[model samples]
Target: MSENNNPPEEKKRPEGITNSYRERLKALKQARQYSVAGDIPKAVERYSTYLYALASYFGVTEDKLSPSFFDTEKEISELLLISHAYWDLSKAYDRSPNLHKESIRCLDQFVKFTNGFKYQHINAQMLKKFIKRKQAHNMKAFQNAYTKIQVDSKGCFIASYSYGPEHTVTNDLRKFKQAIVNYRLGFRFVEVYYNTSPAIINFLEKSGIFGCLLNKVFIRPTLLLISKSARHL
Candidate 1:
């Protein structure tokens, strides 16, 4: 197992998922055409090639595979499509657990990825909603520890806890702090309230800035929705 230092950048996730299915569909159709033409060997070869592609797509050795092994979104989608193809293959070959396992893998991906917000694709507004929820808890902790709160000149609400013990601060708080820095990059005033829950912590840990401080710091008390009218100002 050699690691690739630079993997190919994917097309946007939705497009990539669609294209994978389209390609496999074409391959299956071609195999069907060969079968109808009475070329059994060629049909089998085409299917074998398709199966190889599916295995490669999921990064698994065909003989030793499991539903648990397929984790990434792309891998799961690939497995789902391949499982459908396997059903098609059963018409030509003997049905076995080996062939049916792809369906199981698809269900595994669905269960694992669908149960949490982190796996779900969300928009900017939804993301902000999650941030606001997390910071609510952080704000409570902040208020309890350091009572100092004031507005800075740039319109940022600063909850200064410079003297507060570090132990009181959690990873979610650090992430909320980083998010505020990013949110206030252009605007002068952003409100920050503190508190947290699972949604924000998951976002923060994946954000690559969990423990890392921003060049500037703050957290938002509410989700900011700048409309067209506000943009002009």
Candidate 2:
């Protein structure tokens, strides 16, 4: 018989983990392509997908995919992947017009992951501090805009209708609305909402039971989201 010279096969990851890793890699590749092509929104979408896949690959929820949650002794590769994903995603979000808060969050995650690394370039910690200061400045701007809005102006008609106009919830929703209007396309959206919401509010007011049902189904969840997002801020 002829002597066999074939090398032994390499060990493989389990099928599910391998598939998840492939999905994460594919998303990262697409994100990079979009970033290079100057399609930042698309890049952000793909990077988010990559993060979701990365979380799945590690069998953790997306919120729990941070470095502090991983076991460094056994998951160095996972930690490295998470670090690079956060870094790239932060860069992508930084370029997005409406994603300032998300950009800061991603950068924070990147800084956390890279804290102990010996690579001397980038100075992510310093960059984060600078970005945070800029964010504080932006928040002040948002506050100024909020103050400019007339108190009588029906803010977030749906929210105002659901939670009485003078309620703290309504005021919080107004603040959120002001933040949205500070973004690039946000003013146009507000215009559209202003034009259409009066009629919707009228109808909701007329249909008392239906409006109550809708509030329970819609407004409650929105309030929950707002509460969570406020905590992040």
> Which candidate comes out best when scored by TM-score?
2
Error of 2 at 103 (Å): 1.5
User: What digit string (tens of lDDT, one per residue) describes model 2 on residues 17-85?
Assistant: 556556666677788899789887888788788777657665677666666655665555556556667
Candidate 2 has what TM-score?
0.41
Q: Give the Å shift of residue 114 in candidate 1.
A: 16
lDDT of 1: 0.37
Q: How far out, in Å, is residue 82 in model 1? A: 1.0
lDDT of 1 by residue, 143-197 (tens): 2211111111111112222212232222233334444444544222222232222
Q: Model 2: how far is 105 from its true place, Å?
A: 1.3
Clashes of each: 18, 0
Q: For model 2, what is the C-alpha lDDT against the true structure?
A: 0.58
Q: How high is the lDDT of residue 214 in model 1?
A: 23
C-alpha local distance difference test of each model: 0.37, 0.58
